[model samples]
Target: MARRGKKAKGRPISGWVILDKPKGMGSTDCVSKLKWLYFAQKCGHAGTLDPLATGLLPIAFGDATKTVPYVMDGRKTYRFTVRWGVQTTTDDTEGEAVGTSDLRPNADEIRDLLPNYTGEIEQVPPSFSAIKIGGERAYDLARSGEAPEIESRIVTVHSLGLVEMPDADSAVFEAECGKGTYVRAIARDLGRDLGCFGHITELRRTTVGAFTEEDMVPLDELIDVADENREELDEEAIESGAKARILDFGPLDEYIIAPEAALSELYEVMLNDDQAGRVLAGNSVLLRGRDAPAFCDEAFATGHGRLIALGAIDQGSFHPKRVFGGKG
Candidate 1:
């Protein structure tokens, strides 16, 4: 008889891991690296950060992956530096410089320009972006010297402030924006608006939804702990030990958030044993309590603080749209 293959490794770990990503690491790579270090069965990130950018990258594991959409749709905050008088093909320092000017905007000029960018505004994404044109990414088109016809879309910039006039040729800014907003585009447009070519010199994401820099762990720190435990008997042993070191920080139970924490902004309805059973079965049931509504679309059904199902209320009923890993 032929020998059977070995069983798959890694734990069915569930929850969020906020990583303070460093520059030069792509978001997809960061997710993959963290997935291996944690030995999680599943992994995903809230948003994609450019390889040239750094900071808060919320990574979800196993059941927490179900809540990725909620975090992805939430507010985002960024800190970026705009280098005036020079523009590049990629609209960032890494790209070849395509244009330059001697004119630089003064502090007062930048401050005056901030109001124009705040609130709702029309923005054309940078050509060198992940946005799709036909079946291909726009950046891929730009890379081939093909101009991707990108249209303007309304994106909300909740707030924009001039953080500092760091030098005669650059200005630092902090922006609170909604999903789909591009800081690179902002720098490019700001340069044009200021009568000088502009490009991003540095960029960092400070927050995404309820997660922030305060909740992030540097990848190197986590990797070092795992490296020290390499002599452990198995993958689980090393993963457990690495988590133990990280858990001392208290932001996570074991390098993972409580699964329910992913949907913290949504209203929660704790179900009774019978109701929990119904939800786990992928069935709808009436919710008990004064806050229960006819249509609580943005709600989560929980049992003893554990996520049972995420769904909506219709006709005064709780429905299980997306059940957790335990089939609930």
Candidate 2:
């Protein structure tokens, strides 16, 4: 007889954790810490934020991981401050100064340049970015003393405006843009256009997809909540040292937003018991009723207010692309 494989540890919890990522921590590190805290079976992030940047980082656990692509495809809003006079290799303060300038543009001058950057435009990502070239990350190659040529691609900027000018050396701006848009590149290009040569001094992402700063939970707060619940464990378990072994997600579950929250943009179809069963089994269910959509390239099915599957609608039938667990 064949030997059975070991089962994965942790609870199979599923939800979204909108983290207020602290500065000096990488996105991957944030995910790891949250996973360990929640003791979740699976976890992922919708987008990458540099270690120096802070604010909203949408993390997905278990079934929510299936919707990461949708969250990443949503628009993002960022507020950043640019130091006008020096350009860096990374286009952020984390990099070394590659060039300098003495010129500074006033408020009106900066506002005048905003329109040119709005709408679709070509942008070359920073050399120290995560973009891959020849199967290696651009940043990795740059750190190895190799100058990797990064190609320019078109990205959409929904709106760009000057928020304020704190001083002659720095200007604050807010931008709402589509997926793949680089805020660092915006600051770099703005400086170059103004002949001031700039780099991002501070960056904060306020929104990503349906997640906003309001949804963010600080790490300290989560830690405090978990620590406070330790007293609830039984004395017997504590004496046996099984208290540490027990992974009760009840305390932390309140902070986790429902997984369907990430899929708000997709068309949702309410399914009956039979329909949901078929969807859960990786099959198609005919969309009926007056409100039924004729066709949708991407949509989700929910049964009894719980997510059943992420799929597509064609010819009046919803085909399950990814089936999810749970009664919903």
Candidate 3:
């Protein structure tokens, strides 16, 4: 008999890659670079970070993409520097200066006033943003010299604190907030609140979901590592040395916490093998023998399962809300 083709090997590696995005590059550019590096079949980002900002950016590959929305819904933290006395069209250092002010509030005054912004409050997004109006991107309209009316959105600011007051005209602060919150708007509003126009001079996202700046690997460092690995293969002197050497490249699991780890904060329900199978087969579970919320009514209207994954349980049934496939 002829030899078989060695069973076609194993499946492609899949997981998340958290990049420490460099300033001046858009989020899409980061994804494109990673796709080439890994030769992945599919990839996507959980959220978009501004080109002017730098920090933790979660890029999901394979089945991990299914868990992205849960991760993106988590809270975010940022540290930004605001410069008083000038306002800008885009609200950041990159924008053209549009207005000026002479008043400058003292550090103590700003610290005391910071409390008013904490907790739940409504905020308006900057004009030059990604928000859509009448199905057109706001920034596209803005670049055409047309000012479209933007609406205010209600967002929660979990906490706000002054980090430093470098001078009478500039201050640094930290903000913890929910999704969709804009630091530029906060800076702009802070200036107006204090009787002076203001705009952000610097902004950096320190944290997104569970990932933080500490977990980030600089782009230059990554590029250097890649170059070093390539050199090592050349020295090996094998016919396919480069390809063989790169094959030893490990999975990017350092950036991905366990799938369940991402949902540890949520109420958990374990399912038996039968329940797990049913969930995987697309069926809503009644979740009997446990205190799980009544899920029968919430099951899919078509009777097909909508759960994504199932978890371990000592006893009783818990429906799967999400599923993870090794090759997803």
Could you say which candidate leads in TM-score? 2
C-alpha root-mean-square deviation, each candidate:
4.7, 2.6, 6.2
Measured against the true structure, the TM-scores of the candidates, in listed sequence, are 0.89, 0.93, 0.79
Rank the candidate models, highest TM-score first: 2, 1, 3
Pairwise lDDT winner, candidates 1 and 2: 2
The sequence of per-residue lDDT tens digits that candidate 3 reaches over residues 58-143 is 87676666667766888888889999999999999888998898999998779878887888888989988899999998888998
Which regions in candidate 3 have their CA more than 4 angstroms from the true location?
Answer: 1-12, 231-245, 251-256, 268-278, 283-316
State in Å the error of residue 289, model 2: 2.0
Window of ten residues with lowest summed lDDT in model 2 = 242-251
Clashes of each: 2, 0, 9
lDDT of 1 by residue, 188-231 (tens): 99899999989998999999998977788889887876666544
Better of 2 and 3 by TM-score: 2
**lDDT tens digits by residue: candidate 2, 132-186:** 9999999999999999999999999999999989989999999999988889999
